[model samples]
Target: MIRSEQKSPFRVYRGATIDRDEIEKLRAGTLVGSNAFFSSSFCEEVAEMFIGTDPLAAVSPCQSPVDRRQFVMFKIDVDLNQTADLIIADVSEQSNFPAEKEILFGLGTTFIIKEITYDIHRNLWYIEMVVSSEMFELKQEYTDFVHGCLKYTDADTLFGTFLSGRSSDYPAGISHLQRHLRKMKFNDPNRANVYFYLACAYRSMGKYEHAIEYFHRAKLLQKGLSSQSSYAYADTLSELAATYSLLNNTAKALSLLKQAVTLFRRILGANHIDMPLYYTRLAYVYWQEKQYEDAHSLLLTALSIFKEDMTSVFAGLSFTKHTMGLVKHALGQREEAISLLKETLEIRRQSYGDDHPDVAQVYYSLALIYADTDDKRIAFQYAQTALNIYQAKLPKHHPSLKRASELVERISSYQRESTLPQSEFHNVQE
Candidate 1:
């Protein structure tokens, strides 16, 4: 814990004595040995890979290591960031001495940043490692661990695929992730983070209930986990709330969101970058409940914060504008609503491209605006565009496609009726 704290402004310890052998073992690439003890939190990313009904087991235990008896040697990978100095320290503090006994044991290699360098031309980071011969006795498992780490590092690429609107590539990476997560022991604090990301990936794929399960596991794993960060707890709370919202349990979502909001306010005060997100979420829930006044008030506040920060996150911007448009349209402020919608569409198109789901959503919103305004011609065009985009890119029978098709058909019918001749209308009337 001291080592983890050493890297942060909130650190409570400095110049504390560390076990000499543990330090040497950590420096020597001999992590995951039998005697390790983690003072920091586990990696949630690893845990999220296995949150649903375990294909092999019946009841899932909240505070236990997963049962991986049926699988072959498992691989584990962790992405190392310089800011994760605390994670490195915690892993070192928990490791075993030459003859120590502990609940969690690791027998894997380590790669420090000094011996690794990124090759710009090759677009790869290379490392120089020397494994201890004594540790080589567990060579096969160690090799699997190295393989697991390599595979886990590809999460960034997988996340990129998701952002680029290629969510299908995510599940393909799941098998590797599942195998890696299963191999991890109960004491691996790093696994907590692994679970969190895995939950995010699940949520991205619209596996809401599945995501909620993993999110709970991540929260459980966070207990007694050490960190240099007070921000970690608040981040988890916010994530869980968002997941609950996705599950359509807005009451729980609101409760959790408020808790997270208070935590963030405590830690970062009222004007933090994350503060607006919480407000935005609260506004959305209000909007869902048809509390237009409350929703509008909160959205205006969130938008002001966002504007002042001037931070760039296209998805967030698009969502805020789209929601504001909805609230305005509901309030019968069509001109304001149309302006916001146009801005949202332009921003999303520039950032995500015309074919992106978010871009399609903007068009869908515009179609609704046009539909309500009795401009069936423009409404039908936008609806058709949205439907075509969804049908070509998304899976068959996707809800977005269905909704878009419905809108198109509604407008088409309206258009046909409006264009009928007066003589024909009179004859039908007679």
Candidate 2:
């Protein structure tokens, strides 16, 4: 227990050595003040003397495993001053170790002390003498430990690997980080970020259901952290809406997308660089609903935003152009559609190389246009090219590969029928 002396200018309180279990009990809020060893008479005397006195005026010496001994002071508030029943003194100055002097250091800090009682089971002495700075230091150390693991194995490298389209490596990297975070008891806000990134990784791998699950988990966690704001939460909602759209849950997708748009507008403003991307995403959803006029208007706005930023060669620029081409084709502006599609295809090929899935998609679009124009030979060539790329890059039963394969067969059948005898050709065509 700490002993106190009443001096003229300041009151000195000396504290007892605390055990590990006692410290844990204090942190857990299981330690009660009534059980402290200090006498009621001693508590009342100290409380009366320090009633209006600043907590900084009283000093205590505390023992630390790292520094051996340190002097810590507290900024006592009205609650603490009124509740104080005993005085603790500085014990570190008596030791041969150097005195680490700090005065009025812990001002503005808050501490909670339970009501003092005479229960023998509770150690009130430790409660009265515990300095807030010591607890603060311990918490800071724990936060450092959790963050140190992230620095040791950089997340940026893993994110870069994911961005490079190495889907096989991406999940493993994020999963490893997630496991570490869970094991370390990371708090809600940081954990939510991890879940959000995991959802994005799953989306990139075409696992829309898994992406939706993680995105929902992230959203719930984000909501729990009411004091914190996360920009990534908005992005997660937008991506989740896209996954819903892929699953043909159009109603849910539109609702979530609208929420995402509102959040992005609130957090980043409408003039931010990311605004055009969000607009483009909404436009694509409208396109899927076959609302060509609405989609076209959104695309025009996105294009204007991109042009204002002078980012015409950006990847989003190509994506917006590609969607616009599809919109034009659906509107029966075949000539304009072909020109836009060709421009998008060239941009994609230059940005992602010829073997990329995006390039293959463009090839499929070109094949469709040529087939509609009655250029069967050119259509067949483009379809074959698209099919080869899809078969190499995608799963055998992927929808894209199936579509490309079907187009190739249809074009081949047409070519064969056109070459037969006139009567035979008519019969085969029919």
Q: Model 2 reaches what TM-score against the true structure?
A: 0.55
Clashes of 2: 9
Estimate every model's Cα lDDT from 0 to 1: 0.56, 0.59
In the range 1-430, model 1's lDDT, one tens digit per residue, is 3333344322111111223242333332433332433221233222222332233543222222222221111122233322232233344345553122111213333323224332333222223332123334445554774566555334543343344233433355444455557877777655666576667666655566766787778777665444423455566677777767655577987788788788778878887765776777777766665788998998888788888877555557667788888788778898998899899889877666677666677678778878876677887788788787777665555556666777777777778776411110000000
Error of 2 at 424 (Å): 29
- lDDT measured at residue 43 in model 1 versus the true structure, 0 to 100: 33
- Candidate 1, TM-score vs. the true structure? 0.55
For all the candidates, what are their Cα RMSDs to the real structure?
22.1, 24.2
- Clash pairs, model 2 backbone: 2-14, 13-88, 13-89, 14-88, 14-89, 34-117, 36-124, 43-85, 61-90
Per-residue lDDT for 426 in model 1? 6
Which parts of model 1 have CA positions greater than 4 angstroms off? 1-186, 223-233, 417-430
